[model samples]
Target: MAEAAEATAKTMLGEISQGHLECPICFCRYKDPKILDCLHTFCLNCLDGMLSKQQPSTGKITCPVCRKETPVPDAGLPGLLDCFFLSSLVDEINQQERSLETQQQATTSPTCDACEEGLEVVSRCIDCEENLCQLCKAAHVRYKRTKTHRVTPVEHPEQKEVPSADLSKTYSPKCQKHSNQEMYFYCETCKMMTCGICATIDHRSAEHQLSEITDAVRSYREEVNDVLKKFQKSKEEFKANEAAVDHARNRLKIMVTRACSAIQAKEEEDIAQIKNKSRILRDKVTEIGKKRDDEFDKVHTDNKKKMERAEEIETAVTDLMQQADDFELLNLKPKVMHNLEFQKNLQFERVKHGESFIGFKCQDVVRDKDLGEILHEEKWKLQSEFGKKGDWDGEFNCAAGIACFSNGDIAVNDINKKRLSVFTSTGHYKSMFDLNAPYGITVTSHDLLLAHCEDHVKVFDKSHQLISKFNLPLTGTDSTDQCFISPWSNNKTYTSGITVDKTNQVALVDKKTGVTSLHSLDGSLIRVIPNTKMVPIDIITNKKRCILSAMYDESELRCVDVTGKVNVTARLGQARPAGVCCDDTGDIYVTVHGNGLDKGVGEVLHFDPQGVFIGCVARAMHWPFGITFSPSGELVVADYYSVKIFHRV
Candidate 1:
């Protein structure tokens, strides 16, 4: 029991020494503790040291804890508000420590404050704040004034507990200016507790709103509770967000693992195919080598037989000349001469040039064919639609062409209305200007607008003012004839679709000759793409400088390089593909005028860079013609009567 009591005493002393009893700056017991406006308390000497380090001209000092600036009292550190509650707590802790030490040492008991003679304290009165012996305790209960006070036996000072009434009687801090009066009110303007005398004097101004301290505390508590409720809701939202992020992370991990497995499987399959091809090539090489060796062997055998025949004939002719008579030599001479003549006329075949060399030609990995492509299989939904078939400012009679500015503004050209209308990205009407037979439109890198009108292309500035106009050269004719008769069927030459390449070269499609030609900004012919098989309706350019033409006659989307090399030619069945455009990711979008029973209702189809069909983006459109992507990557399609916008979800 004694050991437990000592331990308890040590714990209480330790808590007091480390907690509110200690000064934050001094890291020791607080001496003359002063509270700042920020509600942080520190030793008076520590505050004085902090103040002395600052410039004397500055009347405010920053808090050492929260860095909030507090005005210095007029009389300096001594004029700061004293913390009377903390002072009393420090004294109570000190007294408890001494009492515990005396109990541990088994010293004499404490004397009673109410006894005249020196008498040991038997009990303590909570409300009267006095210690009493047995005799004084009896008298304290018997008196009328002190009889209502609650008293408890003081057998162990360490284990003493104060009554609730005693706790309510704890000291209220006095005002800094009026030291004799306790602070009773709070000045809302100054945000400070003030004594009654100080409230009537310093805080009596109209700007200062004074409230009783108890009322102020109650109101502030409610306000803090409301804020705390909001904070709790925010905390729950953060937790929900965290959980969603964790789920996404897990899903990403699963996708990565599946992708890795697929890549490994492809790698194994490709390696096996390569090995099989290598075996076949090696076998072919061996067969060719053996055939060449056999041909060389046959030539060697024929040459060796001729040499042996000549040697034998030489021996026979020599023997007949030495040993036989002249008749025998004469008889063999004709045969020997015949044999020598035959040998002299004979010639050996030589190996052909380059026959010994065997070469392996390797195709380019990136350019010859795509090893793989990073495809964005994004799905789009119709977000909004604007404009209608009317003569209004925001309406279009025949929305033939569409273009997007770098600032997300959309420009639509109406062929029937003969006007170019501009709208915000959200499809709100901005302005319109008069134009003639505008079919296709595009915006240049410098934000200049180019519109294909009849046989000429009109260039407009950012303000929709005509800057210049250039006549498109007639097909098969060098002259820039604005009105040239088509040589094919005597039809007038018409320019339908137009697009600008990366090098600022314009590609204009002529429906009469079924040929798309590239031209400079000044309308000088660069070259013609040899695509005369199908009538080209619309054209666009990708990042690779390849022109994508929508062939309405052939129902196909054709992609060709600037040099007329065909890259991809995708057949769209019966749908007459038109209004071709590419996104920032190089994915192709073609608006098709539906065929068969679905005539008049058009659909927008998406494709990869290589012209592989991805999916249908938008369907059931009323003759969609021109297509373009907004600056924010939204799809803007110019239908016959309205402009439709689609966003990737």
Candidate 2:
């Protein structure tokens, strides 16, 4: 039992030494421990060293653990609150270690600090923090000044009871300047604990508002408790948010895995088809070559036979002319001439095969136009609609541009109302900020708002504070030519829409130049997309980094790569395409103003990433303009007068 108790004591001592007794900064046993307002404790000398390294003009020290700043008292580092509890703990730990060491050596208990003789201690004075022997204990009880000091019996080595510190006594820390006087008052102005002497000498002014330490502690505890409660709620919120983000991450990973598998399967299938086509093509070329070779052999044989007959006839005719009579020559002439004429008339079968036309016409496999597409089965339904035609706070007057924050909050640019209205994902109005005829708006990857106002883009922080503004590249149009272009306007000089990609690059459409251009966050021109012909109104980018632009005049939705290569173009027939957005799956949702039958009606069209029309998401709207997807994957549309939200089923 004694051995077990000793082992447990050693374990506990080790824990206390490692966890609480050591200073965080110096990583050693604390000497004159001080506690910051953030509740982190460090040695006084360590704090002084840290303060000396900081800018003295700040007059504040930062906690090493939490980085919370606390004002340096006028008395400096020594004036900081002393951690009495921790100091007592350290003292107790030291005493326990000494006791354990002596027990392991089989020596007597610790000697009494009061007596000159080397005597084993029997008791400890909690107030004086000293060990005492039997004689010293009796003297301590009899002495008038020390009799009131609380004393506890110290466990001897032979005793079965484990040694423990006397932690029940209340510790009153003394003032650093006035070492003898206990600090019992708190100065409101200085925000530091002080003794009676220091309060009278330094904090006696009316502004100081000196109060009992107990009262001050109670008020501070209540305030801290209130903040702690709020923090607890915030922690819960953060936990939920973290869980949601993790779930999304897992889902995305699973989707990526499945997509990889599908792509591999498709690749194998395409390779097999290509190989089969190659084999067939090779066999056809071989068959044509064999037929041509046979025809050439037959022609060569026939030509050789004709050449031998001509040579025999030539020798016979020459002999007849030289040696035979005229009559004999005449008899052979008719037959020889007939044979020559027949030979001359004979046409050896010409090889029918033309010059070798059996070669492969290689197509660009990298940018295969017929490469398969991803099928999106999303079915969207109208979830809710908010706002009406008015100048009220939540109301909208010509809702033009729409963008969503990372938290699913929606911001709409009401051009006619001259305000930027914000709403929750569920269509609940939150707040609105005034702006000057804002047309196109986009939320950057950092959640900064960039609103197009006339010739420049105004940048605002999350709090709606104006950070900075930059002018868009001059379109060579003067101020007189600069006119406000509505979503339905066919104005060529209008700066129609803006979007931010994953790289935080701003892409905008300039109808005047009939081109789409990319810009930096500060509105500096990066590069204009070459070969963009159709007049674009609204633009958005997908996860594939392909820019999707809505050509209002041409009634087409064109998908262009970042390098200005047109990938796909979906013709909307008579309907005019306006605002465009892409979902997480890279599927597109375009808002069009007319359905070929009714010019006043509007509908949201859904398309796959390859620009193939899937189906109509929603219809029978009054001129839908700007469209975007919320963080929750809900489709948000800014119609003529109100904002409509749709959910993917």
Candidate 3:
């Protein structure tokens, strides 16, 4: 019974020891322990094994329990000292174990596990893990094999409290490769731990930077802290850049919304005015028709009365001649004659020929010069004029096309001179350069210009140097690089009026064939826009994804949408449109060449989007060809030998 009871006591004590003193990794008694940033304790050898296994992938020590990353310190894992509190607790547990063994041996009845001897215990042999009486102890010492074993007296007269021991400092780890040797050093070059035997054999080379495991651990801690600070700073910078980009995006949205609202309001006002004018003209026509109908009815009634009197007199004369004799007929002759004379003298009212009787007059219904007054074009005052017949810049010499740059500079294509002339926004000539029969010029970018020349498109830089050229294509050609000129017409090349769109596509028209073509930036023809019935002279684009072509031969403008479909064809009765442009409000402006060089006069005409003639915006010039608007919506025109600028008052 005593033996069973003693066994029970020892089992309870061992369970308590394992709970406080064992290393979690190896499930053994604690060895050279260290603490991590998360406050968890691990054996020194265990830390080295974990870092070696994970460092290649993570480049840092990852806590096994919490999965927190810690940068490996330069001094390495062993430089971290054993945890003081945990070490002290382990020491206390060891003391308790020894004290419990002594108490079991001192009891009146006890048995030794090693010798299986029943005795009254007098001493305990720690090495043999057995209890011994006086006789057994003497025998234990006399035995040659057991003499070196340590024995302790079981009886102590005074009772003393056992202090807690630190298990972290008490443990020593054995090498897995060489189980008999303890791991004592670390190889920095190989990032591995080694025992004393391994240090002399495997790690003996000069290339292996051997270090005391503890020293390397201290260096690792310092590096970890430094890297953590850098990571935090980078995260803050990324957040600030994101906030700035979001702010700019929101501001742009607001700007677009306000601009669209103002444009829509102006559109509504112009439409209302057009409707009111139509109503007035319709009412005037109705009143004239009603008055003419009343006057015609009165004339019809008077003619009917005279005809009835004549018919009555003819019937009475017939009855007198048949019934009465010669005497009766002669007596009725005078009366009949008087009646006939009355009928003969009766006349229908003569219609007035000088005034409009029933039809509406064109002058009353359509406003030509008078439309400018309604739109308040008088407020659009002239800013300046240059490039005139007598100007020092020299006459334009048949300028055919004009374009405005983003920076407010102006470029003109002088077909007669075969050169391009550039001027400031205020009409001061900047420079001129030779181009082969330049017909159209447009700014593809701030520094690049695309010019339509005789049979090819030429690209030029801001310095007026020709950079590249490509021939315009025609049908039955293998590529867009075909160049051909018909013998019948010298100017019947593949290109005429040209413009660049927001998408960087070049749109040009064939003047002789009336076929419009869209080309890629690299001079490859994408597709041909269907030809319109009227002859296309000049082309301009609006923000509505539509292009307007001025028909030189017809008194009309052709509107082509982005899909290459004709949207509308409208006529402005008198003006012969040579060049066309549009403002932000979709209001079109055209330069008129009324009767050619002999009698033709230059006039800038304005019209609404629907082709209702708004009026002549400008008049009384030699002849105007190309018309455009500045960024501020000011009118700019190439008047044959002059360039003119006009602005709103």
Candidate 4:
């Protein structure tokens, strides 16, 4: 019981000592405790770093815990007073350590060597380090030669004394290589600890740069300070990283929440539309059934009237046969025969068309479009290729324009080859037609094809035969015969992109001067928008009739309305913006050159109608120049070598 009580008391004291020894800043035993104005204790070096990070304009330090502001003193953070309470606690702990050591030695105290009988000792002689009892302590001091031997109590024990010149003999550990010799030298060149003999032999070379063993102690202390600084910096970095990760996690959760809400809203709208359509069809069916029921009721009334008339004729014949003459009977027979023939004719006419009047035809109606609704199965995948550079009868050299028809056909124009090649939706070579210099192609109507040539747009039917040729009108002029050239040079002019709007108006860009011109398909100029601020390369239109053009100089896409007015423009963050096409859902796919993994290669990137980034559709192509969406929403890209297609998965 007494031992357990002692153990409990020791454990309580240890906890109390740990609490008093801790520094508030590092939460560890204090290195050099300092007191702040708020009486809060922290490590002096930790406080120094905290004060350094504060803005100089404040001229005051805010405590990290309590946020209490204190004016900066003339000597800065180092001027804070030392913590005397912590210092007293440290001293008490050291004294307790000494007492514990004394108690441990008491168990192993030697018996007095000079005593008559072996007895445990309580005093020691410092000169000889020998234990003695109280009675022997007096005699030991009374001895003439031993009186000046500096006798002390045996309760306290520490290191043994040695000669000053042979201080290496008192080393805590002897050398590993030479057990008899203490390691007293440090080799600066080898960066190792060595004994005196090894230093003179193995590291005896002049370039070895041997030094005193204490030199390493000084360098190690400096290295310890550097390590402490690094530890502090690492802690701060971890805190910052934790904060950034939490922020990103919260942002993603919010974005997902918003997307889910939008999806649910679209679902509700589609349900409402379906319900409305169902209600309308139900009412129409009821109304048609009532109208046909009324017609059958009229036929039933006519049959009832005929039955009454036949009964009247039978009663008259009975009356005439019983009392009247032959003349009266003959007259009744003629009327009855006429009535029977009329009833027979009516029955034949109504029964012949009974199938038509008996029931109403019900036809199924389908909704036309989905208003920007996202479907679960709408994913992208790659499809087949058509015209290659060396393929038989279907060769295209440096193709740069692509367009898709409603009949699931794809048309591409090769500027170098000067031909417009047609392909099936799944990328089968159909046919090709030659032109002067085809730059861009688009299906203007169901059967009409518009191809922008060197100086004019040539219209063609499905058979690749030229139907009409409309030369691009000169800017600020209306004459079809006159051609406009960039003021920079007459012969260096080129048009790279063309798009037809809902009004059969052709929008084309002059690549050299960045001017876009709108013209009618009948070779008439409407209006010109000058200084588009980007080198317009490819153009497309949204359902709202807004023209979106891909720019080459800054790798940006710009929007213009049908009135030839520029609206919003944004950079796509690619090395080169080559071609752009928007699907029915306002999702745009753009081809950018030099953004692929290999040099001079390219990729196709997707974006929304509002210019928000979606994702990448296809990647790592050999310079994809033009892009378009097939009727089924598959992306058709004009690679330099061949055509590439991506289908909705």
TM-score of each: 0.40, 0.41, 0.40, 0.40
Comparing candidate 2 with candidate 4, which one achieves the higher lDDT?
A: 2
- Which is the leading candidate under lDDT? 2
Q: Give one digit per residue, the lDDT tens place, for model 3 in 65-144.
A: 65646556667886553455455666666677787666655543555544555656779999998888888899899999
Q: List the lowest-lDDT window of 10 residues for candidate 1.
A: 160-169
Each candidate: what lDDT?
0.68, 0.69, 0.61, 0.60
Q: Which candidate's TM-score is highest?
A: 2
**Candidate 2, residue 62: how far the Cα is off, in Å:** 88
Q: What is the RMSD of candidate 2?
A: 40.1
After TM-score superposition, what is the CA distance of residue 129 in candidate 3 from its true location, in Å?
99
lDDT of 4 by residue, 1-649 (tens): 5346445645755786676677767777676676544334678778878878877667777766546566667887666555444555555565655654454454455788668767778788888677788888888999998898887776645533221221112223466789998777767677556789898889989899876655655554354345345444544443433333333233333333333444344445564555554444434434443444454445445544544443443343333344322222222333323333432333311311111111111233346543232222234667787666763456776678888887988887776666677888877778887755534677775657887775677888777788888876554322332222223334422235688876787887654444577888787888776655334567887766778877765678788875657665668665667788876545567888764335346888876555655567777787787898776556889886788888653
Choose 2 or 3, whichever is better by TM-score: 2
